[model samples]
Target: MDNRAIGRCLLFLGDVTEPGFAKTAFGLRDWARERCVGELRLPQATVSAGLPQLTCEQAAAQGASALVIGVAAPGGGIPDAWVPALAAALDAGLDIVSGMHVRLDALPALREAAARSGRRLVDVRTPPADIPIATGLPRSGRRILTVGTDCALGKKYTALALSRGLAARGADVSFRATGQTGIMIAGSGMPIDAVVSDFVAGAAEILSPAAAPGHVDVIEGQGSLFHPAFAGVSLGLLHGSQPDMFVVCHDPRRDHLLGYPASPLPSIETVIAQTIALGRVTNPAIHCVGVALNTGGMDAAVAEAEIAAYAARLPYPVADPMRGGPAFERLLDACQETS
Candidate 1:
């Protein structure tokens, strides 16, 4: 069936302060616009003037064929307020749609409400993964190192290092496709597509009764949480498989002394906080492994030391996996315990 037939899609933006979410939404909007999906809406207060709507009546008046409700992280479960707001959308004869970030368990209740009101609803996450080789499903036994979105982000190199480092230590590791080119593998090399395909097949194998649980795999995420292009598929996939631990890569370039103009990247604290929040939202027990020290500085030692120190203060253990092999091993061991 041609699933592209979205009768109407109303985007309900959540009030996630994370930059990655905003970036992802913008990217989704652009992609949807190209596909002619539907109208996208954000809460008035959350966005700009004349865009606010306290009820579905306003949305309907604005010619919204579907109801998209924006929310912050669904705290304490689905908020009490969403129930009525959704009801109003149904009363207005509109389909109710939400982002994929919405908790999976909450869908039934929202669907029931939509059903009662004779309205349809769906989560418009990840755009249906039409990539020829991409299944958009979680694969088991694949040790994945998902990188945060944002260009020049060290996720690609970091994931590469982790995979190589693990392989050298006799741990079979697989790199998930981040849709990027020019990734180098230490051993027998394959394109990112083939690697992911193999990993998916391996995951299926692991799920079989004859398969074991010790297989390792890793995947990379494409955009920062706030980058409009950031669709957190890697994170979702990792959570689905309940990976041993999540290793976050950080970059430290101190151009502050050279009068470098401020870039709009989120502060390290913000990134870490959002990551933790995502971890809690997905799987709380997932260990957080930190890898820092990018060589993009005049004083590599100082930069590495500074970032290493900063990473140490966080809730997770921070180390230079490239340099501190022993520490990296400890982190890997910890991730395995949870797996």
Candidate 2:
């Protein structure tokens, strides 16, 4: 495979390092393969070793076609380390994709540096208030299920299990996938009957059909709010569809225990409080599902306890879908009631 055709891809790992180096690298490889189509090679070139200090000379040494500089600032903090790295990557002759978690207010210097280095910059951030407002569609149903764009979040698995759970309970359920990779799975999965992708490509394949489904419509969000794939096009798709309910899938280890992105990630209590404040804007209610227990590195007990505690505080239920029976049933019940 030609390195140029493969599009040299590089990413800076921040809290992303905790997700496991191998998983993160492979995930990006899959992302490139799926999105690049026949234009580029499948396994994208990637390197990681903590968040390396980026410089023009160092970036040139990596010799990649594109670079994805990820600074895992969950609450939007930009490390001083990113500016030079962004400049270096641009000098190395690579296209740049920036995650939204980076402090947008503080990015002008980096943006200017990138421009001087002759690199294209892409930003992926979703304003909490305007995240779902991209569409004028009214709330069509009481119940809704949502999935995210990032692969690690496990949106596809959650959607499938939720659909099966709903079918088992005999609710009129319609599972809709709003991104390319997801639509592929929906086409093959027995649990889901309908699939849509291409809203990002300027087609309304997902929204138009979902607008009037008599039953509940479960839609998926593509990419992380900070990932390039989810920025402009994906947000537009979500806005047009106007999901009635939003389900946030997060890693409990990152959310509650490991203090993700920083040594002091807000506690579950804090998150709940903030969600209450934000929920009023997106929907009258919101649901959260923690997959930290299923994330393979933590003790099952820790995840179980966290889910139990978090579920109690919020208006929704949280569980370990890896258990696959009653846990999924609970999720379906929540979806039905909300729908």
Among all candidates shown, the one with the greatest TM-score: 2
Tens-place lDDT per residue, model 1, 181-243, is 211111112222223332532332232212145666655544455444333443333433344
| Model 2 per-residue lDDT tens digits across residues 95-193 | 665434443335787667666866666443311111111234345554344433233555544655566566677867665644322333332111111
Q: Which candidate should be chosen as best, given lDDT against the real structure? A: 1
Q: What is the C-alpha lDDT of each candidate?
A: 0.46, 0.45
TM-score, cand. 1 vs. native: 0.44
What is the TM-score of each predicted model, taking all chains together? 0.44, 0.45
